[model samples]
Target chain A: MYRQPVSRLWWLKKRTYFVFVMRELSCIFVAWFAVFLMVMVFAIGRGEASYQRFMDWAASPVVVAINIVALAFLVLHTMTWFVLTAHATPIRVGGRRVLAMREARVAGRIVPAATAVRVGGRQVPAAMVIASQYAGLVVVSAFIAWLVLR
Target chain B: MTKRHIEPIVWLLFSAGGVAAAVFLPILILLFGLAIPLGWVRPDYNYLDAVVSHWLTRLVLLGLLVVMLFHSAHRFRYTLHDGLQLRWEVPIAVLSYGGALLGSAAALLIVLTI
Candidate 1:
């Protein structure tokens, strides 16, 4: 058995690998968000004065910029994870695979329908999985917005 | 007790954390990190305070914080291991999971206090 030698800079050797590395690196931003929220929670727990100070700190140009970048990476993380979920877990409806109909022929006429996106041998459509994840994100975000901003 | 036995548990935490962060972190970060801070949206302090003080909110926050920490830990662990090509598995796992545990404990304390 022979194993090919790989370099530590392999991630830099290709665009997709680089993207994968960036995806992995998104964990740092994720951790940062968690810590930031913890700090905010602590401030809120401490009362109005501390919470105001937190807001002021958060408003600083540097913090805002970092957060903007974090937001971008987080979006990437969400997207890649959702796509992976579609590939990894196949959904079943009524003990049958959930599929998005691509096209159906009726009476010698082609009728357009939902696009079918299958992952290898998996029966569930990738589009359906991705769509459901995004829908979930939308609903969750909307609820949070309502809770916070209402 | 054995490393084999611990592997599945760690993976479970990682998956839970990944799902939690993917679904929840984006919106939360957008709100607190960007929207509120950038003045795109204003959050009333009293109302926000009341929301945070709610028992359900505290519970949810605690759960999210714990899982998110674990998720970060697991990913960072692999990033160091395979990405950075580090061979020290024991130390890496210890630090990654240990930090997550500590963060979870702190989150629990903070949320309970709130």
Candidate 2:
């Protein structure tokens, strides 16, 4: 059973809800990673004494396990969460005409970069900007994992 | 083409993140398992920045958090709509804008506090 056709209680599905919660709230794990990074930065910025204390504090088994679990959750959540992005922004081609599934598929597959007169206003493709943002995110996330993992 | 397209860049950013998760998770889990007992991947390491003094590192952390935050918030907004089956633009608009605003504020707090 999916979300009911038209009722207010549709937003909450037990399974999807858990997955979304696991995914969305996994931001907390990323937050944990970021905070750890900030503290490390500040500690290093502060002094060797601070850095020593930081490592000593992190050496506890309980704390380490939590980060690991958080990392696992963060990874799973990120993948599943982003897959749903396609539903968020559907594209329409042509003037006031229905978007056929074939056209939608083609558009999604290829990176389109054309300035066309949209239904009401013209849409200019900013392909470069989008590319930069995604690249930045991937590089950044990967770099951090490398640092901590190493 | 006479058709307006959904910005492929958006999908690329989204799916790229997804793909990263796919590629990265196994490695993380493996490391976490390997490092868990050694005091390397500890819970408090979540606060590893306390020892780091790297500008590039902090910036990277910020980038990752911001991207993940926006990506999550944006997706969550739609999940609300699709799951709720809410057809009215007015309410959907309010919910999404409000959600984004709240999420952004929370992110700022997290960033600023520590």
Candidate 3:
């Protein structure tokens, strides 16, 4: 399908690319996040001591490298993901979406800023607003941590 | 679906998933904290292996991967077209769908293998 010319480019700038980079590189976390289970499978397949050794080695510096990579990306992804909540965020259980129209409008603007900032753009209002949303995400995540951890 | 219905559905799934991951993160940390003192959750043991062992966990993993994949797809796709001025629409579409597919596969495989 020959589509019409698009107006903006998302992956071209620093801030915009931050989210893009976060998204593309996020695979590392999903891969490594599941590593424990993967190692478990490996350990179970091999035997007990080998599993223990694997766990130890997995916790080693090199493994930590993998984990740090995984963890950092996970945080990046989480932040990026949470950042989406302001606009793209919805509250739907039983498939009934409860997000109002204004929330949807905000989400529409914010979600693309992740891309907009990348293409040599200046949307300060959008950025500030989104940053505030991130503030909310931090608060919410903290609250969530409190709730979940407690 | 009309625009009203369509957008809400997307945003709803998107928000829900983000919150889900947000919720899961701390829980996972706590799980780790407990597993440490308890000793039964030994690092030597394959906990990841155990998650995949349960069919429910497997499905949950798959759901998380797929939902987030679609959410990201919806995200990255629009950003590329509207924000990135990328002319190549096919690749973006392919990747968006492909990510979901591959994510589903990886999630399922990890589970089934265990």
Candidate 4:
């Protein structure tokens, strides 16, 4: 069977493809965060001196710069993931699916009465799903902050 | 007996991990990586130590670590396959999942000991 030759740099050919690759690459940063948490926990388990040493290493310029970059990629990952979720998961409420339907309106005497009859057919919107994800993020972050900062 | 497919199991972990990481990692990273280290948010060692040593806290941390690692592994496996065009599927799967397992074991040890 014949096939089109794919370039090694195929991801760079288009903006969306580049972004997709970057999103995939963001997993590295996610893994880094997991490792970082593990190390932090290990240090905390050791002693005050070990924890302080870990903090000192973390405060170094190199580590800080790496984390800043990682943070940017992670935010991108979060936003894209949430947006994708809205499309992938069809949320249901009271046996109704959230849909992108427009409200029917009567124009004039020529307009059909059937258009106006569907007024009470209310449905949830996809935007609500996206908004709720952001709200959940805020709540989780706030809880973590309260736990740590308080 | 019929054989069970592993794709759905790993995919479920990947999806859950993505949600867990999305909602949780940013704040933790912002605090521990940037804010506290840069002196923006002062951390009390005693308070933090006590919190880390808490059984509930350790349990939560273990869960996060395991899921996040598996999530990373699943994503990275695809990144290698599709992004880098690495055709070694079995080795990649073994390496990725194996690494996540190792990380989870390490997390279990650290959290349990702590």
Comparing 1 and 3 on TM-score, the stronger one: 1
Model 2 clash tally, residue pairs: 21
Poorest stretch of ten by lDDT in candidate 2 chain A:
A99-108
Clashes of each: 0, 21, 12, 0
Q: Rate the local accuracy (lDDT) of all candidates.
A: 0.83, 0.47, 0.50, 0.82
Output the chain A TM-score of model 3.
0.48
**Highest lDDT scorer:** 1
Compute the DockQ of candidate 3: 0.20
Better of 2 and 4 by TM-score: 4
Q: Which stretches of candidate 4 lie over 4 Å from their true place?
A: A95-123, B1-4
lDDT by residue for model 1 (A32-136), tens = 999999999999989999998998999999999999899999999999998877765655544443435344342233433223334444356779979989999
Worst 10 residues of 1 chain B by lDDT: B1-10
- Clashing pairs in model 1, backbone N/Cα/C closer than 3 A: none
What's the i-RMS of each model? 7.7, 7.4, 7.4, 8.0
Q: What lDDT tens digits, residue by residue, belong to model 1 across residues B1-114?
A: 227667556656766778788999889988999888778998899899999999999999988888889889988987887787777988988998899999999898889887
lDDT of 3 at A62: 68
Residue-level lDDT tens digits of model 2 in A24-143: 555445445534544544554555577667656655777677766876786676455444332322333445633222222221233332222234333323453345435655775576
Q: What is the Cα-based TM-score of model 3?
A: 0.50
List the DockQ of the predictions in order.
Answer: 0.47, 0.17, 0.20, 0.43
Model 1 alpha-carbon drift over 4 Å, by segment: A1-5, A96-122
Q: Compared with the true structure, what per-residue lDDT tens digits does model 2 show for residues B5-85?
A: 533433343344344443344344444433543555654453444523255544544554445444444444444554444
